[model samples]
Target chain A: MTQALVNGLTLGAVYALVALGYSMVYGILGMINFAHGEIYMLGAFHGILALAFAQHYLANFSPVVCLLGALVLAMLFCGGYGFTLERIAYRPLRHAPVLSPLISAIGMSFLLQNYVMVAQGSGIRGFPMEFGRRLTETRFSAFAGAEFSLLEVFILATSLLCMAGLHLYIYRSKMGKAMRATSQDRRMASLLGVDVDRVISATFIAGSALAAVAGVMVSMYVHAVKFNDGYIMGMKAFTAAVLGGIGNIPGAMLGGVLLGVVENIGIWFLGAGYKDAYSFIVLLLVLIVLPRGILGEQVSDKV
Target chain B: MNITWRGFSGFVFVAALAFAAACGPKGGAGAIRLGVAGPMTGDQAAFGEEVLYGASLAAEEWNERGGVLGKRIKIVKRDDQAKPDQATQAAYELVSEGVAGVIGHFNSGCTIPASEVYHQNNVPMLTPSATNPDITDRKYANIFRVCGRDDDQGRTAAEYAVKTLKVKKVAVLHDRTPYGAGLTDQFKRNIEKSLGAKAIVYYDGFDDKEKFFDPYLQEIKKKDPDLLYFGGIYHQAGPLTVKARELGLRAAVMFGDGVINEQYIESAKEAAEGAYVTFGPDPEKIPAAKGFLEKYRKTYQKPAGAYSIYAYEAANILLASIARAKGTDGKAVSEEIRRSPHESSIGTIRFDGKGDIQGSYYVMWQVRNGKFAALQ
Candidate 1:
């Protein structure tokens, strides 16, 4: 039971990082940003590419330097990609009906997925497992003889740090205040001298960067990378975000961890086959019982 | 108004005529195309990608060896995304592309729908892994399988569990999909037949996406079965083994070919260390498969999966059939496949009257140190 909890929490942390991106964007933009998942995938691909380059050129460097360089590269590339997506796909449709932009987001998601698929052939590529070998050296007793790897610890810590940064940005930073203002009322924010487009783009870039970090962490853990990783992980993160409260920042963190724990416990109790259903069922139940989520403030549309 | 209506009718008639003309056979001197359809995306893409590699390699080898029936063999590939509807569409697309035969629709659910299109279009389809008995039970003349049916694999697994493992009490779990359910049914029946009342507990029809299994696990724990058999893919099997271990169940866990993948080890972690699974012998271990592996690794820069050799053998068989038939005609090629005794990576290959392989060659392996090792 304890091992399951630890495993759940580790996975939940990654999900939470990815979910925060979704929650943050939704909080400010009132849009689902379906392409968020594709950014995560590109992040993984960038990590693999960076590792390859490190192996080829920086062979003399320590493994830690190589991994850190890869992670940074992954974050930058994915962040840039996210910014590009917002500028090219979302920006034009920002003033259009909400449905049009939503559809465009979905289209962009497919386009990015197909782009990766074509570039990376339709095969499961193996990443060098040794990329972060040193980091996984630490082991902690979790439950009933189960040991937690250092990779898991790194994932959890990084996720928490990202979450903290997000919280600070949203609550304390000037641009973050403008984001909240724009989310609360776009026209009013524009009238008050806020650049709504820049805020929205910034929201996407920040979320994309977080997602990229999560993707790199996941690739390190899984040791295999594929184009479709985003689809499943994205769905789970979205579920986590919704579970915590679709637009609630802290709620997403809690929801991600809770969903992970629920899934692990479900697998432990029910058998592994029903893990996905268990998560969805929890989401459905939460949505039905507390539509605004555990920490979200319920909002009523002003007619 | 009358002139506009007359013009519209004339346009419709001309379009119908053009459609008919396009559908008509365009026979020319060119290479015969064989379509290979499978999930080239989504979760099961690994399986499909490997199969395509095997098929493509076979086509290349056949073309190099003086071509098939004085013409080059070409394989047109399609991504089915593992969905039945998409499989059907892919099948039509392949048929329209003028392929003489198809090598797959890898999943039974997808194959079932895609097979109908192949049947309607008179294209022979030889499935590599789809093992549902109903696939061939429909007796579609164009449909056949290179891999053993679920009944064979399930019965073989059960025999190993009851006789070899000396499992006294066993519990069965299935993913509730057609393939999973069918395999579980066969396994349960065979185990009961061999061990009599020893096959005590049977739990079938579990959802693939559900995360929690505590209620079911608690109930299963009470039964205290000596062995557990899971009829599902790696996604579920990996976690199932891990959770079972966590639940303090020391029972030996076994599964069918669906759970055979490196992903299972990663997902299940140490829990997969002792789990056994029955599948077509890993190509890496086969002496005949060595040459193919070297060539595959050189070309694709990766080792082939367990079933890739079988897929390669299947393609070899199809090409040989076309060569023997001396034409790309579906009925003639299928007749050749039925009659010809071919040799390839998986040993002597011959399909029985029902389009099933003649030999019962299933290998059992145990996961050890995050890799599958052949059980002695």
Candidate 2:
């Protein structure tokens, strides 16, 4: 049970990173950004590429430096991808009927998935396990039956650090203030001299960057990435976002961790095969009983 | 437009037949084109490329030996993308293109549907990898597979667990794919036959897309099964073993041939050690495969994949059957294939009545020193 908690927390941190993207995008644009998962996938790919580059070009760098460098590079690339995706797929359909953007998001998701599949040969690309060798190999017991490792600690620490950084930026930064204003009332914020486009764009970039961190962390954990991996991860994270309250930022975080715990517990009690169904079950329950989501309904507008 | 279901299907079938007739292989002395279908562009392209290389190498060697019946062999490639619908389309396209036979389609899901098209068109289809028993159980005279069926491998694994390892209280899991589920089903059946119904403490399937297995491991640990048999491909198997070891689940990990690839080791790292998987004898180690391996390395400049030699042997047998039958006639060639004992790199090949290879080749392989070592 204790080990389940450790596993759930690590898994939840990754989900939270991704759920933040969906939450932020939906909060601002009223669009799901279905392609958000693909951004995460690309982040993994970019991080892998960055790792290869670092290993090849800067052979003397420590594993920590290499991992952090890859994370930063992946974040930057995914942020740019998110910005471009909004401009190409979302921005054009902004003024169209609501259905158009949703359709566009779905189409954009397919397009990005296929693009990666075509470019990368649809095979599971294995990450070299050499990085974080010590972290992964070194083990410590948290309790009698539960074991912990440095890699899991690193994953949790990075995720919490990113969350903290994001919180400060949103609550303290001027641009974040403009973003919150735009998300609350796009036309009103525009009328009040806020650049709606820039704020929305910034929202996408931030969400994508967070998801990129998650992508890198997951790649490190799983040691492989495939073209269609983003689809399921994306759906689960979306569920997390919706479960927490689609537009609620902290709700997304709570929902992510909760969903992860529920899924792990479900696997523990039921079986491993029903892991995905547990998340969707949560989605259905949240929809039926708590429609606005656990956090989405209770908290409003302060996304 | 006036249309009825029967009439529409009739017209479509007639048109397809006419098109096939129009483009069917001409009785000429140019080349014997064999359709090679697999996921050439999508995720399984690695295996697809192996299939292509294996068939092409066989074709090239046969051409050098003065060709089969004075005609050089030609390989017509098609990318199935590992999708069932696309595989049917590729089969149709191959039929219309007038290939003598097909040596391809890595996934059983793809192979099963594509076999129907081949059966309808009288095109001999030989799959190198697709190991699901249904591919052969349908009794399609035109369809055959080089690899052992799922039941054979699964039975081997079950017996190995019971007889050799003396394991009790086994837990079986699958990915719910045809290959994965079918293998586990067979294992369950055989295991029940040996140890009765109560032996399997847990039997279930999970989504292939699932990444986390901690909770499952934890729950399974409580069951305290002596063996955990995973009927899935390597990608999932790798992580399962890693997580099992992480959770301190001391149960012996066993898997199907799908987990025989090197990527399993790469993902599971040291955890792959002591893990057991069922597979045929390693073709790379056999002395009979030296020449073929040499040529394969020289031509492709890479190590042969799991199914490469199987594809090579399939191609060799198919062409030899054609030569012995003195034509590319489907029924005649298939009969010849069944009738003769052909010597090849994988060993002497003999087909049973249903076109399944005679006898079982499966043996338990344990991951030792980061490599699959056949257990003595």
Candidate 3:
């Protein structure tokens, strides 16, 4: 059970990273960024691309350096993509009904998935293990006589660091404050001289960067990257975000980890097929019991 | 408004013409169209692609050989998306397109629904990988399978585990899907029947997206099962094996044919190194399969999966029967298929009254260095 918890935590951390993007976007724009998952998938593809390029051109570089380069490249590319997506798909629908942008986001998701499918034929791309090897080497034979891999440790630590940084940014930074304000009241934030457009765009970029990191981590951990990775991972992250609190940043983190842990436990108690349903059931139960979320502050509109 | 109505009618007429043109003849009077259905997209796309590729190759071969009864064999491919509703739709489309027979609906979930359509349409459908006993038990006159059933596979794996591995205790993990749970049930029954009073722990199927299985592993560890049997596909099996190994569990991991894909190897990495599985008749061992394999590699530049060979054999049988029937008529072809001794890849295939393959053929395989190798 402890091992499952660790596994769930590791998985939850990745989901949390991706969910942060969704939560952040929702916090600022009050819109679910369905394209977040695609952005995450692009991050993984970019990581694979960077790794391939590095192996060919920068052979002298260490695996860690190459991996770091890949991660950065992935984040930058996906961050840019997120910014572009906001400009093209969401900008025009800002004043429109909530369903408009949501549908546009769904369309964008399909477009991205199909684009990748056509560009890269339907073959499962294997992420090279050169970098993964460095991270997941057996550390020590301690718990249940199992040895932890460096990759697993890196995943947990990297997730925590990213979460901590995000927390700091949301609470401590100027743009983060603008984002929080925008989420709270878009018109008020605009009146307070917060660039609502810029803040929303920045939210996408930040969330996308985290998603990109999560994507790379997933590719490394899973070792198989495919076009549809986004759909499944995206759903899970969205679930995590909702489970925590749609607009609560820290709530998303908690929700992600909780969902991951619950899924693993469900798999332990139930079977593999029920895992997806198990997580969804938890989400449903949480929504029924704590509709405002674990940390979300319930708000009401003035009558 | 009149102009627009005329234009719309014209468009509909043109589309109808185009559709007919697409289904137009390649060879003389009697072209046999064999329908192939599987998930060309979604998670199970790889399996579908392999099945389609194998069926296409068979069609090409039959057409090259002066056609079936001097009639060209054409394959009509449809994507089921591994969904029952889609499978039924695809089957309906294929039947309407006047296909002589169908080669699949790969998953049993899809096969069951699609098979009903084929039965209602009086179109003979041979499944390559839909192994649920209920599929054949329905005794649909039009439905048949070229592959071994789960009952055979589960029993064989259990026998190997008990007699060869000599594992005193066993724990079975399955996905809750029909394929997963059904196979697990079969394995449990066989293990218990073979080794009575020998503690056999049966666990329900888990989720594929789970991050950890430590709780289950912990329980299994406590039970001290000598071997672990996973009745699930590669997606979950891969991680389960890896995590189990990581947690210092030394039990040998085993699964059914679902774990036979190349993706499983990539997913499990070192954890799946020594995992065992039961597969259908070995393709490499079959003499007729060598030619097909060479052609498949030459055309696609990749070795086909084991199930693909079954697909090829199924397509071959369908075409052969069509040739013997000498027409695309469904009932006539079904009669021919019922009577015919199929000689193709995987040896001479003969179906019993229930459309199950006559001979009992199943093989045990082990994951050695990330590839399934025939276990001696």
Q: Score the docking of each candidate (DockQ).
A: 0.13, 0.49, 0.40
Residue B288, model 3, lDDT: 73
What is the alpha-carbon RMSD of candidate 3 to the true structure?
A: 3.9
List per-prediction Cα lDDT, in the order shown. Answer: 0.81, 0.86, 0.82
- Runs of candidate 2 with Cα error greater than 4 angstroms are A1-6, A49-66, A88-121, A127-154, A297-303, B1-32, B41-43, B63-72, B83-86, B162-169, B189-202, B223-226, B324-329
lDDT of 3 by residue, B152-255 (tens): 98899999998899988898887666787889889899998988746586465564444346567767876778899988776667767766775567889999
Lowest-sum lDDT 10-residue window in model 2 chain A = A294-303
The regions of model 1 sitting more than 4 angstroms off are A1-9, A47-73, A119-121, A125-154, A220-223, A265-274, A285-303, B1-31, B42-46, B53-74, B96-98, B120-122, B157-309, B312-336, B339-348, B364-376
Docking class of 2: acceptable
Q: Name the weakest run of 10 consecutive residues (lDDT summed) in model 1 chain A.
A: A294-303
Task: Write one digit per residue (lDDT tens) for candidate 2, span A1-303.
Answer: 787788888899889999999999888888789999999999999998889888888889898889888999999999999999999998988899989999998998999899988887666776656686777778787875777778889999999999888888888999989978887888999999999999999999999999999998898787678888898889889989999999888988998999888887777667676677888888898878888899777446544
Ranking by DockQ: 2, 3, 1
Docking class of 3: acceptable
lDDT of 1: 0.81
Residue A176 lDDT in candidate 3: 85
TM-score of chain A of each: 0.96, 0.96, 0.96
Off by over 4 Å in 3: A1-4, A52-60, A120-127, A139-153, A265-274, A298-303, B1-31, B208-215, B218-224, B269-271, B369-371
Model 3 vs. true fold: TM: 0.89
